[model samples]
Target: MSLRVGVIGGGQLARMMVPAAVNLGIDLRVLAEAEGSPAQLAATAVGDYRDLATVLEFAKTVDVITFDHEHVPEEILRELVSAGHSVHPGPDALRFAQDKLAMRRRLSELGVPVPDWAEVRSEDELAAFLEDHDGHAVLKTARGGYDGKGVRLIRDVGESTDWFRILDEDGRGGSLLVEELVDFRRELAQLVARRPSGETRLWPVVETVQRHGVCSEVFAPAPGTTSRLVDLAASIAVTIAESLDVTGVLAVELFETTDDRLLVNELAMRPHNSGHWSIEGSVTSQFEQHLRAVLDLPLGDTATRAPWTVMVNVLGGPSAGDLTDAYPKALADQPNVKVHNYGKEPRPGRKIGHVTATGDELDEAAFEARSVAALLGSDISIAP
Candidate 1:
């Protein structure tokens, strides 16, 4: 009998995993939030992931459960475990990814390098943090934030009045996460996969370019990373995964500081946007690796397929119509580039798809990827 893996949250991550599951012969099932979700191809059920009855019914069909995103309630996840269902990157490990404030405290306890941060409960607290950080800081809600949403740059306490109000409205009276603005030279991501048996593998750290807080492009192996920097990044990811007892893919977003230090920026306990290039760039894509790790199967080699691979996100599809409308021009403009459309309608700053190119030179690969991405009407410019 084939191994069954049920995924919660049917977004593009779940959609991308479908092809990997097919090749591996694992039965992939998704519990999508709604009809016509990106992962509709493999969606076997549709309902609220937070609903116990809905999720319990879906859990019965799969041998193991994983996630496409981290928004599922922790109580539901723990309940699944209590009922004897296997949930990879189990609730304990997932808590760090779900709540940024919790993540910082835990990472600090683990002696992980991270920016100075605090859980600020009021305007005075935020003001104090800002004053100490050169009058600038990044404020984030503890939960439900991603893709630059639920995040803000603040130099004054007044800027966070609304967030404070929202916190006040919550009966529990939560605190906001405030961090010293990192003086980073460039952003880097390290992708690693850890199986239930504790075996782990890491891909080369990659450089990511963000526009308007959304990932715009990636260059595999992070151009100009010395061997020492590469090793350090890998070490950090491995340490975190093992420390947290994380199962399945873990993406560690990092800040390469101007002082040559690497600090943890954020964590994602599932296949992440940064590793999307691996689909065509590496021998084992993150999507495939995620399934393998969660199933406790032997992981695949993570070596790069080319010397340089570039991934450019199709941030926004054509203003006039669907992504397919630009396919003719996009496909022909860069024949060698690979495009993965999320099958979504165009909207400003939405990630509808991504294009990747692998070649001997970074410049050539980036150009091909960018050219195709531009033709597809990415909101960002093609110029490097």
Candidate 2:
């Protein structure tokens, strides 16, 4: 009998996992949030993941459950477990990703290097943290924030007037997280997968380029990363997976500080955007690896197929139109490029899809990845 896997939340991530599920002969199913979500191609159920009854009904069918996004309420997840269901990266591990405050506290307790941070509930608490950090800080809501939302900069008490407004009205204390702005050299991501039996494997540490807090491109085996740094990243990822008892993939997003040190930035307990490159770049894609881990199957090799691989996101621009228009040019201009469009309509600043290229040299791979991505997003054109 084939293993049955059910994913909660139908987004691009779940959509991307379909091919992997097919290849492995696993039954893949999705619970979509709407009638025509991106993952509708694989969805068998459509409803709010937060609705306990809906989730319970869906969970009853699959042998194991995973996630596309992490917003499923903790109460619902806990209920699933108590009812004899298997949820990889189970509630305890997932809680860390669901709540920033809980994550920071646990990482600190584990002695993991992280930015100076504090949980602030009121304006005065934020004020004190900012004062200690030279009147500069990044404030974040403890939950329901991603892709640069739910985050704000506070340079002074006056700058935090809106949050202070919330505090004054609702007495929101201990609901916000404030941290000293990191002075990092660049962003890095370490992708690791763990099976329920305790075996784990890692993908090469990659350098990620972000524009206004959104990931723009990724370069595998980050150029100029020393061996020591790579080892450190590996250790950190492995330690966190073990500490949290995380099953399935865990992406440890980090900051390589200007002074040559590493600090834990964030964590994702499922297949993440950072590992998207592995689809065309490695022997085993993160999507397939995630399925294996959750089912306690042995992992596949993570070795890169090429010396270098570059992945670029196909972000939407002002011109929201059918992306197929870009396909002819993208295919003709860069035949070697691999493009995966998420069946999402174009909208400004939205992640519609991504393109990747692999070659012997990093520069050429990066150039083609970017050029193809631009062509697909209407950022660049191939004129006759």
Candidate 3:
């Protein structure tokens, strides 16, 4: 019998995993809230990821369960584990991704480099944090925030009061975590995969560009960054995965401080936006590696296939028409570019797909990727 894998959340991640599952001969299924979700195209089932009954029922047919997002409730995950259902990146490891405060505290305990942070329950607490951090700080909800949502920059105590009230009134507020905003040179990401057997692999660190909290582009090896820095970031990713007992793929987002230090910024237990470049750049794409790790199979090679590669996210723009029209134009312009569309309905600011280009030179590949992305309507210029 073929090993069956059930995935929670039928987003683009799960959609991309389908090809990997096919390549590995594993039966892939997804639990989604509705029909026609990205992953539902290949999933064995479509249902609510948060509904225990749906999830449990879905789990019964799969050998192991994994996730596309961290939004699944911890209680439900624990219940699934307790019931003898194998869940990779289990609840213990997932909690850190689900709650920023929990992640910050644990990273601190592990002696990982991270910004100074504190949990705040009220404006008074926010004020104390701000005073200590130089009157400016980032405030984030402990849970459920993503892609620029649930995050605020407070310049003073008054803003903190407004934030506290606004978040509380929204009924989605959880504990708040405030941190000193670092003057970072750039953001980087380290991608790693771990198996239940304790085997692990790390990919080359990449630089990420974010616009409005959404990752817009990624450049592998992060121009001008030394091999030493890449090794350091990879080590940090492996350490966090081992410490958290995480199985499957994990992404550690980092901030390269002005003083030349790397600080942990965020964690994702599933295949992350940062690793999307691996699809065309690495011998083993993060999606494939994730499935391998979860199934306890031997991990694949993570070495880059080329000296440099670039991935650009295609965010829906204001053109308000079918973006597919640009595809033929893009392919005509750059035939070597690999484009992956999520099959999602276009909406302003939503991620619809990504384009990746690989070449011997970093700048050339980045230009190709950026040119394709610009055809999709991004204002960012491709640096030649």
Candidate 4:
């Protein structure tokens, strides 16, 4: 019998999973909030994921429930689980992805390498942390922060006073975390997948470039990285998945310091932006691996298919014309480049699609990926 999988959140991640599900002969369905959502083009239901009635209805038609985002409420997830619906990366495991403070506390207890952080409940606590950490720090909301929102870099104690006041006035003062600003050499991401049976697999560590808290590009097997560093990242990813009892994919974003140490920066329980290059770079794409894991099928190979693979995100810019107009030019110039658009309406700084290119030489692949992204109106520089 073909396995049925129901995914929550109707975004590009779910859109990408469709092809993988089709290839694996799995029946894929999406729970979307509205018509024309990226995944709605193929989803089986249209409703709010937070509504228990809606979720239960969708779950009734599928053998397993998964996610494209971690925004779904834990209570709703618990309800589904109680009803005997199989949810991969279950509610217990997803809480860490939804709340940063909880995740940091748990990882610290697990002996994972993480930045020094403290939960600040008032201006006094914020001041103390800043004083101890060189008078500069990064503050973030414990929940609902992404793409640079709900995050602030405070270089002055006076500036942070207003931020603390705003949170306190809104009764959300307790949902905040402050951490020292570490000067890191670069950002890295380790992607791994776990099966319900406890089997696990890992992909090569990739370098991620972020612009204003949003991912701009990714490089597989991060250039000039040593085998030792790769092993370190893979070990951390595997250990976290096993410790969390995660049943699907998990991405551990890391910070590589000048001292060659790795520090966990963030956790994502589903296919992440950092893993987008795997669609064409790895022997088995992350989307495919996620489907296999959720369905309790045997996992696939995680080897890289080329020496270098690059993925460039296409952020919407101020272009009046339809973005598709650039496709003809991009394909004519670089036929080998693979483009995946999320079918979203263009908005300033929004992620619309991405382009991937692979080659024996890193420079060539990076050039191809950037060229296509530029044609789509992204303003990022491609490194040679």
**Best TM-score goes to which candidate?**
1
Model 4, residue 193: distance off in Å is 0.5
Q: What ranges in model 1 sit over 4 Å off?
A: none
Candidate models: Cα lDDT each: 0.95, 0.89, 0.88, 0.89
Task: Please give the distance, in angstroms, between residue 376's alpha carbon in candidate 3 and its true position after superposition.
Answer: 2.5
Task: Write the residue-wise lDDT of candidate 1 on 86-138 in tens digits.
Answer: 99999999999999999999999999999999999999999999989999999
User: Looking at model 3, which ten-residue stretch has the lowest summed lDDT?
Assistant: 375-384
Could you give the candidate ranking by lDDT, starting with the highest?
1, 4, 2, 3
Compute the lDDT of residue 284 as modeled in candidate 1: 99
lDDT tens digits, residues 1-384, model 2? 889999999999999989999999999999999988888988999998989999999999899999999999999999999999999979999999999999999999999899999987677888889889988999987787888887887797677677667756775443688989999999999999999999999999999887767788888978898999999999999999999999999999999999999999889999988899999999999999999999999999999999998988887832746888778888899899998888888887789888889999998888888888877773331111
**Model 2 TM-score relative to the real fold:** 0.96
- Local error of candidate 2 at 17, Å? 0.6
Output the worst ten-in-a-row residue range by lDDT, candidate 1.
375-384
Task: Kindly report which residue pairs in candidate 2 clash with one another.
Answer: 121-173, 121-174
TM-scores for all predictions: 0.99, 0.96, 0.96, 0.97
Candidate 3 lDDT by residue in tens digits, 139-182:
88888888888788889778667667866887865558998998
Candidate 4, residue 351: how far the Cα is off, in Å: 0.4
Q: Per-residue CA lDDT of candidate 4, range 1-384, in tens?
A: 778999998999999999998887888999988899999766889989879999999999999999999999999999999999999989999999999999999999999999999988877788899999989999988888888887899977677676677777898446579988878999999999999998899999999999978999899979989999989999999989999888889999999998899999999999999999999999999999999998888999999999999999988842776568777887788899998888887787899899999999998998988988887777553453
Q: Model 4 — which ten-residue stretch has the worst lDDT?
A: 375-384
2 or 3, greater by lDDT:
2
True-vs-predicted CA distance for residue 352, candidate 3, Å:
0.4
